[model samples]
Target chain A: MILVLVETDAQGATLVSREALTFARETAARLGDQPVHAAVVAPLEESMATLVMKQLGEQGVAVVHTADDERLTTYAAAAHAAAVVDAVRAEQARMLVAAGTPRGNEVLAHVATRLEVAMAANVVAVDSVEPLVVTRQVLGGSALEEMRLDDAVAVLSVAGHACDPEPAEVPTAPERLGYTPSVTDQDLVARVARTEVTVVDDTAALTGARVVVGAGRGAGGPDGFKDLLELTELLGGALGVSRVVTSLGWRPHHEQVGQTGSRIAPDLYVPCGISGAIQHWAGCQSAKTILAINTDRDAPMVTKAHYAVIGDLHEIVPAINEELRRRK
Target chain B: MANVLVCVKRVPDTAGEVLLSADGLSVDARHVGYTVSPHEECAVELATQVAEATGGRATVLSVGSEDAVEQLRNALAVGCADGVLVEADADLLGPADVAAAVAGVVREREAGGLSYDLVLLGNDAADTGDFQVPVRLAYALGRPVLTGISTCEVQDDRLLARGDGPDGTEVFELPLPAVVAVMEGGVSPRYPSIPGRMKAKRAPVETVALTAARQGSGRVRLKLPPSQPSSVEILGEGPEAAPAVVDLLTRIGVVGR
Candidate 1:
C-alpha cells in the first residue's frame, strides 16, 4: 500500500497535500493499482475533519486514518510522526509519501528515523518501483538528481507543484479509522508554544500573489523602492526584493526572493532593477511571464525575460506607472 | 555555560549558474569557488552568540573530504574555539550515515567528559538539499529537534527558537542538549579578522575517521534542468519605452486596456 500524509489548514487540505495525493495516486497506478491510503493529523473540529476527509476521498483515497487524540492540539514533529507511524503499521504501507514542505519533510524525517528506513526529500518523479529509482530537486531546485532507494519501505516527499491535483474519475467514500498515537512527554517538549501574526504588513500576500514586482540592488537605496511600490500597487500585486536589497537593509527580509526566502509562482513577474542570479531565479522560476527592466541588456534577468527594456529603472518605472495611470 | 557544536557543509558557491560535471555525478567545481551555505553561515553565527552569551565555547565540525577543513577553519576564525573534521567522502554518504557519524561523536565526547549542550545545523544543505540530517541526528541521540528556525537564543535554561510559519512567526522552546536546524536571513555572520585568522591557523583540529555505514542516497546522477527557451523582445529603451512596456503588459493581461 502507498500512504500519503495529508496536511490541513483552517480551510481544508492544503494545496501541497493535494499535489502529494496526485503523486501518490499516480504512483499507486504505476504499482499495479495498489491501494492508496491517507493519514490526517490535525487538531480539527468534527466538521472540519469531515470536510478534510471528503476532500481526501475525492482524491481517490481508499482508507483515511485520522489521529483522534486531544493532546495533539499544536504542531509537534515527533508526535505527528508517531501518528503517521501508527497509520503506516495499521495499513501495512510499503511506501510513504508527503509534500516537501517544511512541516511535511520534518515529520517524514522523524518517521523515517523511527522506522530506520532510507527516505528522500523533494522527489519530483518515481522512475522504477523496484530498487526505487526517483528523481528529485537538489541544490534548492537549482539542479536535479536521479537516485535509488535501497530500503524495503520507500519513503519520499514529492516536490511542491510537481503535478496538479486531479479528482478521481469515480470518487470513493473512504473508510474512516481513528488512530491513537503513541507519544511520549519528550515528543511534546519542542512543540510550537505560540505564534505572532504581523498585522502591520501582510507578507503572505507575496507568496500567493498572481502578479509580483521585484527589485534588486539596482533599486539604488531605500527611497528607490517607491516607484516599484507604486507600480506594484497599480498592478494589484505584491512587491518582492532580492537578497542583496535585504542584506543591504534597504528592504526587510520578508520581502526577499531567493533560496533562503519565499518561492513565488506568479502569472507575471516584473523585475525592475534585479539581476536574475540563479539564487534569485530559484524563487521566481515558476513565473509564467517575466518582464525585465535594466540598463544592462546582458544581465541574466534581461536575457531570460520574455520582454526586456534597456533603461534606468528610476526613469522607466515611473514612466510605466504614469502610463498605467493613464490607461486606468 | 554551554558547549555548542555547529555542523557546516562546504558547497559550491551557486551564484549565476550551476554547471554539472562530465559524468554528472557531482557539481562541476573545477572552476567555481566554495563556501558554506547561507543557512550554515547563520547557524555558525547563532552558535557563536549562544556560546558567548553563556560564557562558554563554540566548536565547529564537518563530515566531508579534507577540503572541508577550510570551512571549519573559517568558522573557527569567526568565533569557534575548536574544530573537528570527520574524514569521509560526503558524496558517498546519505543523511542517515552522516547523522550516525555525528551521533557517534556526541557519544564519544560525552564519554570523554566533554558534552555539548546544544547542536546546530543548517535547515538544508544548499547543494544536496537534504533536510533530514539534524532530525535524524537528534533522534539518534534521543533529543528534541527543531527545524527551519531563523532566530534563536539561550534563555536562562532553554533554547528559544522563532521561525516563519503558516499563521505567523511561530515560537518554540526546547531544553538544553537539543538540535536546531537554522535557515538564513535572521542573523548576519561576522567576517574573520586578521588576528582571528592567525589564531585559527594555529588551532589544533581533532580529526576522526568515520565509522558509520555508507548508506548512500542511491543517487545515480545529476542533470541540469532544461532552461526555458526565450528570445527576449526588446521594447525600445529609456523612459521612451514606457508605452511599449505598457502595451506588452496589456498583451499579457497584467493591465487591462
Candidate 2:
C-alpha cells in the first residue's frame, strides 16, 4: 500500500495535499493497483475530521487514519512525523508520500530519520515501479534528477503542482480509524511556541495572481517601489522581489520570489529592472509569458524573456502605467 | 561556554546556468567554481554570532573530497575557529550516509570531552535540494532539530528559532545540544577580513576517513529540464515602448482594449 500524509487547514485539505493524492493514485496504478491510504496528523475537531475524511475518500483513499493529540495543537515536525510513521508501520506501507511544502518536507524528513530510510524530496515523475525509479527537481527546480529508492520503504514528497487533483471514478466513503502515536518528550522540544502574523496575508495573492511584477536591485531602495506598487495595483496583480531585495531589507521575505522564496506560476510575469539569475529563474520558470524591461539588453531576464525593451525601468514603468491609465 | 559546529557543502556556484557532465552523475564543474549554499553561508554567520555571544568556539565541517576544504576554510575565514573534513566520495553518499558520518563525529567528539552545544546546517543543499541531513543527523544524535529557520539565538540553555510559517512568523524554542537548519535572508553573511583569511590558511583541518554505506537518494543521473528556446522581440527602447507594451498586454488579455 502507498500511504500519503495529508496536510489540512480550515478548508479541510490544502491544494498541494490534494495534488499529492492525485500523484499517489497514479503511482498506485503503476504499482499493479496497490491501495492508497492517507493519514492526517492534526488535532482536528470531530466535525472537521469527518469532513477531511470525506474529502480524502473522494480522492480514492481506502482508509483515512487520523491522529489527534492535545500536544499536537500546533505544528510540530517530530510529533506529526511520529504519527505518520506509525500509520505507515501499522498498514505495512511500501511507500510513503507527501506534498513538498516546508512542513511536509520537515515532517517526512523526520519520519525518514526515525525509520533509518532514504527519502526523495520534490519528486515530479514516476519512471518505473518495479525498481521504483523517479524523477525529481534539483537545484531549486532548475534541473531534474532520476533516482531509485533502494530502501525497504520508499519515502518521497511530490513537488507542488506536479499534477492537478482529480476525483476518483467511483467515490466511496472511506473507513476512518483513530491512531495513537507514541511520542516522547524529545519530539515536542522543537515545536512552534507561537506565530506572529506580520504581513497583511499577501502570500496567497502573490502565488495565485495571474500577473506578477518583479522588482530587483534596480528598484534602488524601499522608496523606489512606489511606482511599481501603483503599477501592480493597476494591473490587478501582486508584487514580487529578488533575493537580494529581501537580503537588503528593501522588501519582506514573503515578497521575494527565488530559490528560498515562493515559487510563482503566474500567467504573465513582468520583471521590471530585474536581472534573471538562475536562483530567480527557479521560482518564475513556470510563468506562461515573460516580459522584461531593463537597461541592459544582455541581462539574463531580458535575453530570456519573450519580449524585451532596453530602457530604464523608472521611465518605462511609469510610461506603461500612464498608458494603462490612459486606456482605462 | 558553548561549542558550535556548522556543516557546509561544496556546490557549484549556481548563479549562472547549470551544465551536466557527460556521465550525468554530477554537474560539469570544469569551468564553474564552487561555493557553499546561501543557507549554509547564513548558518556559518549564525554560528559565529552565537559563539561570540556565548564566548564559545565555532567549528566548521564538510563531508566531501579534499577540495571541499575550500568551503571549510571559507567558513573559517569568516568566523569559524576550527575545521573538520570527513573525506568521502560525496556523490556516492546519500543523506542517510552523511547523517551517519556526522553523528559518528559528534559522538566521538563527545567521548573526547569536547561536545558541541549546537549544530547548524543549510536548510537544503543548493545542488541536490535534499532537506533531510539535519533532521536525520539530529535523530541519530538523539537531539532536537529545527528546519527552515531564518534567525536564531542562544538564550541561556534554550535556542530561539524564528521562521516563516503558514500563518505567520513561527518562533521555536529548543534546548541546548540541538540541530538547526538555517535558511538564508534573515541575516547578511559577512565578508572575510585579511587577518581572518591568513589565520584560516594556517588553521589545521582535522581529517577523518569515511566508510559510507551509501543507502542514499539513490540518484541515477541528472538531466536539465527542457527549456523553451527564446527569441526576444525588441519592443522599441525607452519610454517610447510603453504603448506597444500596453498593446501586447491587451492582446494577451491582461489589459482590456
lDDT of each: 0.89, 0.89
Task: Please tell me which predicted candidate would have the highest TM-score against the true structure.
Answer: 1
Q: After superposition, how far is residue B102 of candidate 1 from its true place, in Å?
A: 1.2
Cα lDDT over the full model 1: 0.89
Model 1 residue pairs with clashes: A148-B218
Our tally of clashes for model 1 stands at 1
| lDDT, candidate 2, A130-197, per-residue tens | 88889999988878999998788899999887887898887868898887888777778889999888
Per-residue CA lDDT of model 1 for B86-182, tens digit only, reads 9998888889999999999999989999999899999999888878999999988989999989899887778899987777788998888799999
Q: Per-residue alpha-carbon lDDT of model 2 for B1-257, expressed as tens digits?
A: 78899999998887888899889999888787998888999999999999999999899999999999999999989889989999998888888888889988888988999899999999999989879999989988888999989999998988998988788788998789899999887789999999999999998799998865667558899999887676899999999999999999998989893
Badly placed stretches (over 4 Å) of model 2 are: A45-51, A199-201, B231-236, B247-257
